[model samples]
Target chain A: MTGRTIRIGAGAGYSGDRIEPAVELAEQGKLDYLVFECLAERTIALAQARRRADPEQGFDLLLDERMRAVLPACRANGVRIVTNMGAANPASAARAIVRIARELGMAGLKVAAVIGDDVLDQIREQPRSLSEHDGTTADLGDSVVSANAYLGMAPIVEALAGGADVVVTGRVGDPALFLGPLAYEFGWSADDWDILGRGTVIGHLLECAGQLTGGYFADPGVKDVPDLARLGFPLAEVSPDGSALLTKVPGSGGRLSVACCKEQLLYEILDPGAYLQADVVADFRTVRFEMAGPDRVRVTGGSGRARPDMLKVSIGYQDGFIGEGQISYAGLGAVARGRLALDIVRDRLAITGIDAEDLQYELIGLDAVDRTGRTGIEPREVRARAVGRSRSAYAAGRIGAEVEALYTNGPSGGGGAVASVRQVLAVTSVLLPRDRVAPAVLYEVA
Target chain B: MLLRDLAHVRTGDKGDISQISVILYDIENYALLADRLSVEVIRRHLCALPIFSGERYELPELGALNFVLRGALSGGVTRSLALDAHGKTLGAQLLDIEIISIS
Candidate 1:
């Protein structure tokens, strides 16, 4: 069983990613599994808020639509599904998928929900030490919304071993979604650090889906890519030795070359020699990409050491609120009017006595991105934007109100004035002992 | 000549930190990029917001330089009020750095 190669395709990189590429993968990419890595750093915390509002509704917002779009093709192609789109509630997400599968006339579809990642209760009982910042759970106080431990591949491997046609997970490591299936297929032991490390290299490369296939690589005249508007997602064909050829579906609309692979190899990673994951601490120092064929890149030389003892947990809390307002100016001297508009709002914010933090006033087209103010050529149009973070929602609302008031009270030709406010959900990191997390797998059969 | 003439950049974010990888179009120019694109040069180029700290990693094999900037996202994507919360545009901004060719 371990001798045969297994093919895996990345369905979605993150939540709210496009759906068509995933559908194309299921229909065309001949694969054993299609993994959708959806959850982001603060995604689960916001999902917890949705869960609080309604017990049955904390999963990915596009879960229903994505299932409806991909399930038909997956069932026909014999491609199993794995995803962390379950977000805050994997059980509910599993139930939703089972319902969709049954509706598609595929009855008796086995879906597994990987639970126990939500360790809010564990943190509450023993307040784990913070990792990224200098504080404990006690310092977070009542503002704490959610705390989820980043799970590893064991639970997912267990789910796949139990014959789960679909795996819905909550807060697992992004790479674990792909690594679990690889470990299960190859029978790679958990202690097999080097092989697991190689598998992680593949996981990290394909987790972002289209990023590996030139979707994010196009730079117009500088680095041209063909048919990028309908860019293809990535797939990897892995052998038992942990080596893989990363490629995309035939006739797909994106360039898959060594340049794309090289960029993705270092994406979001700090130290290439020791890229840490729950399953393995992968070393990409000697990793190399060789052009095998069109849209095919052979990846090798990935190794790993032992896994870390502590698991990283993302803790979400209500930080405060953010208020923002924008007004556009057109024709000549638009930059001047936009600057004047920002000045008016800054003065008005002080006069209104609103306590805010991290306040910024920017002219959108001129100096918002290039902060050095070195762009000598003035644009014919510019937008004035004022933003601030405040302790209260009411105070945050005033920042936008001040900008809106500029429509009538301040600069002339300041049109398209818009203002809005939202409560801020900030996330910080904490580390918990591996034994502290109890990962459980539950099955839902359609 | 601008750095964009010889290199391309891609930015990634985790919390409040931004990681940018500057990959050269040609492997031969790695030494020049490694010499000119120091941590201080990037700090000065991005002086608008005080980047709390930065670290540069050299990948000579891949002809790439990876720079990790801390406290750069205005408190990160979850709570940052900036329109571009992910700092996706920072890579493009860094391309403006002028490279004094030593040949």
Candidate 2:
């Protein structure tokens, strides 16, 4: 409430797919803040693989080369950016961003790396218990592929408050990046739950970048939405009374209408009455949307309740190890032949004295009938996969090694040869309440 | 459907869908828009496609019409056509309606 109205923009395009276009918009000098969301569950494994290949590599390496073109203009224009492109390696991503800043001759720009979310090490040290929503306890003895804490806006607010112009973070609550700017600019305290909830709603609205800017409007007749190939992301100009205006860079692709803004507002919310996030539960029912202009929408009438005492936690663990091999079959009964091959493999594993609990099998291309009527289809070809799990990683690895012996010893009446078995880690998930896990035990690595 | 008669249409978000609330000039005109336009009339004629999924609704208070769509997020499945990511685009497409206001 003490600061001037600050406008912040966020977009959902990836650097590999839409980097150049985003850079062009940055050169236009239209935004006060920009946030880029580039991380997903699968992206975490990819980052881990890269770090394993070369420990010196960082998370931003996954962004591809196209983003390099835009760093200079972004720095020159003073449009501070917050990106989760750091993935699991925030220090590496921060170092890369700083290197880019230096190469562009932009000096004295403070870049803050918001770390401590990657909790794999901490989970191992303490080995806490987690229960599911159904009240079942998750088994931690299984192998866990990856685990990271979903950080909230407080760390981000701390980064910005430290006078860092560009903030880079790992897996954080997607909406928190946008809300962090609000908290920093307005001096909103952590205990201001109502305003924090309202800010989170605004962040969710603009989180997808182009959705609020008319990229997905249902209206049939709003014409000429600018350069769609270079669509600009959206910014929310918020007032202390909890009203906001959604707009994008001028001359960018896409249009902004009440319809488009409302569409983004409802995405992924489980309950309209209580739209929950890591920080708060935003009430979408109390919100209102109005058409302010050709490419602008005014969002008002948003009200917030209180926040939950416990923070929702995401816990991941090793489920098992899996090995998959594929072969093509032609002509009649292709699916039948594939099923036969699977039975032979299972028989072979049993013959080797592998316990039933230690093994699992799946056929990707088979048809099965159920109450729903024809649950799956028989494709032209099928990829059969087998998985194994045990208390030890070596036992799982041995199961993967056994799959390759089938290529020469069993099945194979016709068709192509079975590929060599590839060992893969298995992962599972559970959720725990705030009290069971302590955040103080996890320390940020500089 | 007559473009001028679209004045009674209203749009909003309900959960994961972008709902368009439309009321025809009268009960008889309801069939006219339904028969003439089809759902594509609104979708194809609209600028931001793929990112939005649509369904029609009826409101008796003002004789209104509504269409709710599934995906409206830019990076969501509506833009990429991926089944897993389309839910984010639902509400963004709800804000794109335009009517001539013929009352």
Among all candidates shown, the one with the greatest lDDT: 1
Question: Best by DockQ, which number?
Answer: 1
Query: How big a share of the true inter-chain contacts is recovered in candidate 1?
Result: 0.62
Question: Which segments of model 1 are wrong by more than 4 Å?
Answer: none
> CA lDDT of each candidate?
0.91, 0.57
Query: Can you give the TM-score per candidate against the true fold?
Result: 0.98, 0.63
Residue-level lDDT tens digits of model 1 in A1-446: 24789999999998989899999999999989999999988899999999999999999999999999999999999999999999999999999999988899999999999999998988888886677777799888889999999999999999999999999999988888989999999899999999998999999999999999997788888889999888999999999888899999888899999999989999999988889888889988778899999999999878999999989999999988999999999998899889999999999888889998889999888777764547777898999999999889998899999999998899889899899998888998898889988999999999
What residue runs in model 2 are displaced by over 4 Å at the alpha carbon?
A1-3, A13-17, A63-67, A125-142, A214-227, A316-446, B1-103
lDDT (tens digit, per residue) of candidate 2 on A205-249: 877676667564434553335557667677777876557877776
Q: For all candidates listed, what's the TM-score of chain B alone?
A: 0.95, 0.52
